[model samples]
Target: MIFIYIIVAILLLIGLLLLDFSLGKKNHRKNVRFLDFESTTGDYQIYTAGDPLFEDLFQDLRHAKKKIDMMFFIIKTDEISRELLEILKQKAEEGLQVRLLLDRIGSYRINSKVIKELNQSGVEFAFSEKPKFPYFFYRSQRRNHRKITIIDGDVGYIGGFNVGREYLGKDAELGNWRDYHLRLLGDIVQHLQSTFFDDWYLATGHHDEEPVPTETEGEKWIEIAATDGVQLEDVFESLICQAKEEVFIGTPYFIPSERLFKCLTDALERGVNVKVIVPMKADHPLVKEAGLPYMMRLIDAGGEVYMFDQGFYHAKVVIVDQQLCDIGTANFDRRSLFLNKEVNTIIHNPRFVMDLRLAFLKDVQDSEPLNDHLIQLFTIRTKIKIGIARFFRPLL
Candidate 1:
């Protein structure tokens, strides 16, 4: 009788979760907003490694004259993040506006004591996407995966590098972190500053000051594309469909939706070269396995796939025909496509695009091709893992 009662309780819990998810999905579908900002000019500096990126970012933060706004999916309570927190505290104590926004579930490791310290120092801090009643499960699953920083309306930082020791290649397990980050200077900062304020409003329910616009321009042109859980698929689809010569994708996760998979295959059929690079190391269970089927399908369709071997490939980049590059926090997975709030920088500068392409090719050189020999090594256990991954694809 006790066993039967336990089973009944389990079923009831699962039913409740399903219902919450359904309700959240309906609400999310209704609130989907796709933003297309006007093209702006900025001078950009790209960072592939973490140490220099942090050094420059920290310097910029120290020099902020008026405001510092930062939002990230994950911020670890480690050495690097502690340093950043200290910086923000100092800035806020100096009477400068300093606000930090972090995802609720992603930055769970940051304890209350740290937050209290920041608050005491006059730093405005808020967690985005807190779970609510009637759709707790769904809200918990959706995340704000964008990483952006705006300072003084003159400079902007956007990319995939989170605040952590691992991001600085200090983790023993995941050695040598690899990612792509961009530092922009000019009128483009206004667009990203606007994004930070909008997100800040959503997270804290408080209106912030208007962005301070700069009248600077450079050769590089960019558009900041933002998606509210939905509409990202259409953005990616449009980019892929417009590919005329080749497509290069680099991401940590590669579990594409059915429609997205079809888009890739269709691109291949139309003689567009499609190449993808993903990490050989699995950061999360079932995520690597979840991408196996999709990777195999791409390989079978004459697309080239490479597994990054030097370190974890945490970059989210897509290059089309050496003319356009999309780089941001969104992964090539269902979460980024249909659930997470994501922002991507679309670059239309030929010089920058060509430079990024060369960097992509260098990483590809450091990768191993997914050929027949690698596929032949899969055992029955691997097959079972793939099945489990497919079952939990949405969560991954």
Candidate 2:
């Protein structure tokens, strides 16, 4: 009788595992969606410095007509953030609709008093996930990693420069930070606004109708690709599968999914030039350790990878065939691809792509070519770390 009971338990466990696997597959298929680029209808400018990006943001806020909705992963207490807060407080006082959303883990160091002040001053703000029931689970894991700013429902800013002096290359320890931030104008700002409210709605129950931008028509086609958990990986996988001739990539992290690895290798097999650039020194040592295997895999498959020697390369930029480009917050890692709320732009403009390619060329000039010998130099401890990190890659 005991043996019969054990057999029944084993069968039930196998059935449960199959059920879970089936749901995961279905959920992945249900999550990815893309907008077709009819034409380039937007005017966009890419910024690489925090100083310039903040200046433009402040200037827009000075002339903001209706609303300012912002979301970010990191909101450090730097001069830039302080000035931004002061201006936002002033703008809210002027009866403008202003809202801010930040990741609970990313902005964990932010003081509650500052938050209270913002609240009392009528500047609406909230963390992406609060420490309450149902939300606390995976609150730290599924972070809001996107950095986006939309002003007056007409203009938008997207890409990697978070609120800090390091982003502007002011930190002595980490000098000359390189990243990409784009200024967007046109109907696409409406899509950016929708992305913001998607999080705002969850954070604050903001059920208000989406605001319609009053901007003039644009000259090119721009589509926003934003997702949270299980979908972003597919976005990049599709992007890689569609590449032709050439592909340039920049990011701080690189832990490609199995599907992504296959797509990149396949792109190379089709006679495409695939260039991947990552930081020399990662913020998380474990992250760097986790990615070495994939980096070697790409190199072994006839792709080129580089390590930026200037400073921490935090920009997530992808330029394909000098005709299609994507710039925004998603990195080529498990966190950005599968566990975070990310926003990226799919742009189809040859002229813009050319400029982006130029920027990438400049960065390549400053980076060191990566090879298998370099990866093999890591200490045994690091190898152990890589193994452990790989075990957790799906959740990292």
Highest-TM-score candidate = 1
Over the stretch 150-262, how does candidate 1's per-residue lDDT look in tens digits?
88878899999999999988888888898999998888888888788888888888986767876556677888888887878888898899998999999999999899889
Q: Clashes in model 1: which pairs? A: none
Q: How many residue pairs clash in each candidate?
A: 0, 8
Q: What would the per-residue lDDT of candidate 2 be over residues 116-229, giving only the tens digit for each residue? A: 878877889888855443323434456778888888778889998888888888988778888989998888887787777777877888676855854666788988888776
lDDT against the true structure, each candidate: 0.90, 0.82
RMSD to native, candidate 1: 1.3
- The residue-level lDDT of candidate 2 at 274 comes to 97
Error of 1 at 37 (Å): 0.9
For model 1, state the Cα shift of residue 309 in Å.
Answer: 0.6
Per-candidate TM-score against the hidden true structure = 0.97, 0.89
